[model samples]
Target: MINYNPKEWFTFIFRFHKADTFRKLFPLMIAVSLYGFILAYLELEYWSLINSSYVKNLSLMHSVLGFVISLLLVFRTNTAYDRWWEGRKQWGALVNVSRNLSIKLAGYLEDESDRLYLSKLIPLYARTLRGHLRANVNSDEISDLVEIDKTHIPNQIALRISGRIFELHKQHKISSEQLIILTKDIDVFTDVCGACERIKNTPIPFSYNVFIKKFIFFYVMTLPIGWVFSFGYFVVPIVVFVLYVFASLELIAEEIEDPFGSDANDLPLDTMCNNIEKHVKEILN
Candidate 1:
């Protein structure tokens, strides 16, 4: 959600402050002290010629470990992206389902009375779906459009919307065949709702999350020592830079994981719902 120019380093770092407050990097400040002490210990222990020679032999082993962790990090990032992409696809389906259901509801009920009834009801269904997806169903926000009376209380807002379709059938209005077709559309719309809820409620497994976090921290801690013999005090900025890259990616994955949250990176669900309402009303009018 951050619109950053590639040339702007200040903007990139500043963007993290605007992300989830609880996930900020202040807690990780301990890494600097930890890296410094660990690297200093490694330097002192390897001061002797024989010990330095042994470390040179261990260099190949360290290289192999680093390569493996790099691959694991890449895999972790891909898994996070899968969740984000799936959520976007579900929302795309929601857009199509809303349009189809609205058109069918209006086209089937051709009576002046029924058309007027559907004019209000179809948009209400979309608004209710939008609110329900966000878990912020504001009755008053929808009150001007839909008449939410006693019968609409407790549960089954969808059933109330379907009740309009049901009425057309009960009055010897729409034929049994026509009713079945309309009911199928509603069923698809319901599936859209359920799919969106599934993505919103479920998250990547916690064990994987814990493993990635530990892996990144351990990798970063060892990095300073890995370079101490070569870069000496220059290890500070290099270590910070590497850790920052790793942290930035971790932050990005976290942001997109909850695509409905208030974070800037979250999907623009409110805007999307409003657009659905606007387009539906335009088509009806």
Candidate 2:
């Protein structure tokens, strides 16, 4: 995600990042402005609908719909944000679980070979999971460790980690109670993966998303029809500004809804995975 100082309000206003909504919406904003200007000019010069009661009443319709659209956008942005935050929370849990497992293994394992094995395996699980979420698992990364199923790389790594722990218990390297304790942390690895998958697979309803886009389109398109009488030629900028605000909200929502992607606003899966590797190595090696 793009990090910034919250206090630098002026700097943000003056700066325009490539991912900023203004950049994405600028072309559409120009089109909307032209549309609004044409409608306003036609109404004022030729149609002479500026004084018509029907045209005046359309503004009242907009006033009511404006409130309704605000509520819908609020809910849309909130729902998307919830998904993004939940993904972050799941990754946060994975970081903690990796550390806990590594710490326990470091204390329980006596042999240098076993410690080295787990040290590599714990970080491999994190790296594999990061790749799985992005749907671009690197074969080189997987082959460097141990080969298993390619269909589900994370699950294969996780299975290997669990199997090794079980083998240690069988060989009397770690007792039955220590085995139980270690199993708890390993179990959480799958839980975190499943939670991330749920967020990735499921998304906001299709019908609802389409409806919001349609609502914004029609609402902005009709703004010049009614408000031209009041705002006159100035309706062009007013309509464009309104479109900018509403469209920007939708754009931001789309960017953040799938937090696993390469979007600048997405969760920092690469950094988190690297951190997991560093911590595991520090604890176990």
Candidate 3:
């Protein structure tokens, strides 16, 4: 995420961050403007054709479009925001559960080496989950910490952690019931990982996206026709601005729909991971 002072309103308005919708919609904005110009010229130069009943019927399309498209945009934005917020919540849970696991192990385990080993594993699980959600796993950082040769790093990490709890039970460091209680934390980690994976894998329906884009396209294209009759050449800027609003919203929806990504609008997974590491280490120390 791009961090800056919230009071700097001018910077907020002027800064063109990579995730800014305007930058993504620039080419489409130009196209819409050019189309507006063409419509204005044609309507002004050849008044009779656009003045005909059939061409006038196209104005009715706008009547229904404004209300229907507004609803669709609202739905699209709401859904994407829900996903983004849920992703953050899941990661927050992961952070809490990591701390809990560390504290439990440190208190229950008799051996200092066992406590240290489990403390190291808490962050390893977090690091592995971060890479897992990003769809790019690098075992180099965790290879020594977790001696596992498995594709699903998060699950493998959880398995090893759970296995440690069982190991404690076998050594009588923790009783059978205590073993069950501690294992629940690993289950929480598994559940958190599952929830994150669900968000990362499942996205907004593609057909809905295509339909909304098509609707926006046809609606914007017809704007020049309807408005040019009333607004004249001024419709060029009006149409361009309208396209910017519609296109920018669509672009934003796409960006936030997948919250685990490295995109500017995405949840700050990397920062959260680092913070989790720091907090877990602080507690262990």
Candidate 4:
């Protein structure tokens, strides 16, 4: 994610970054300006478009079109943000649960080797889950931690950790109650994995995406015709600004919908995983 300092209002307005929306929308803004300029020149200078009732009536669309599309966009953006925030919360919960697991092992296991073995696996489970969500499990990062050959590496890692705790219980290193305590945190790990996987697999509906894209496309494209009467040649900048607002919202929703990825606006999974690892190691020590 792009980190920045909080700034005054003037600085906020003038700030610029390599935001995905800006890069994607720049060409569209230029195209909108050129489209508006052509329409204004043709209608006023050549006087061909000004004669048509359709050209004159285009601006009348703003009242109903603006209101309805705004409502739809509100729903669309909210749905996407909900998914993004939910993913963040799940990862945050995972970090806490991993620490909890480490603490339980430290208090229960007498042998330092057993505690170290199980506590180390907490961060490995997290890294494996990250790889699972991103669909790119790196062997080098996880090869030493688990068997690495299993297709479901995260779940198997969770099971292996649980199985070791059971072995510790069988050896009388920990009681049955300690086994339950450690298993409770293992359950939490699995729950978090399931929740994050749900977010990754279940996206917003296809119909909603299709409808929004079509509505925004035609609406922005028609703006040059709509506002050219009063603004004339000045419609170029107006259309560019208008397109920027609408398209930026659409792009923001798209960028945030899948928060698992390493996009600038995404949930910062790498940082969260690193924090989990650090916390786990500290508690295990």
Residue ranges of candidate 4 with Cα displaced over 4 Å: 7-9, 49-54
lDDT of each structure? 0.67, 0.91, 0.83, 0.84
Q: List, residue by residue over 1-285, the lDDT tens digit for candidate 3.
A: 667788889877778877788877888888878888987898879664656666666668787887899899999999999998998899899988888877776677778778777777788888888888887888788778676677799988888888877887888998887788787878889898889889889988889989999998888888877767667799899888978888788888888988888888788888888888887777666
The C-alpha RMSD in Å for every predicted model, in order, reads 4.4, 0.9, 1.8, 1.6
Window of ten residues with lowest summed lDDT in model 2: 141-150
| Deviation in Å, model 4, residue 142 alpha carbon | 2.1
Deviation in angstroms for 282 in model 3? 1.7
RMSD of 4: 1.6
lDDT of each residue in 76-113, candidate 1, tens digit only: 77777777787677767767766776676666666767
The TM-score values for the models, in the order shown, are: 0.78, 0.98, 0.93, 0.95
Top candidate by TM-score: 2
Ranking 2 against 3 by lDDT, winner = 2
Candidate closer to the true structure by TM-score (higher is better), 2 or 4: 2
lDDT value for model 4: 0.84
lDDT of 1 at 72: 71
Query: Which has the greatest lDDT?
Result: 2
Better of 2 and 4 by lDDT: 2
Worst 10 residues of 4 by lDDT: 6-15
Task: Write down the worst ten-residue block by lDDT for model 3.
Answer: 47-56
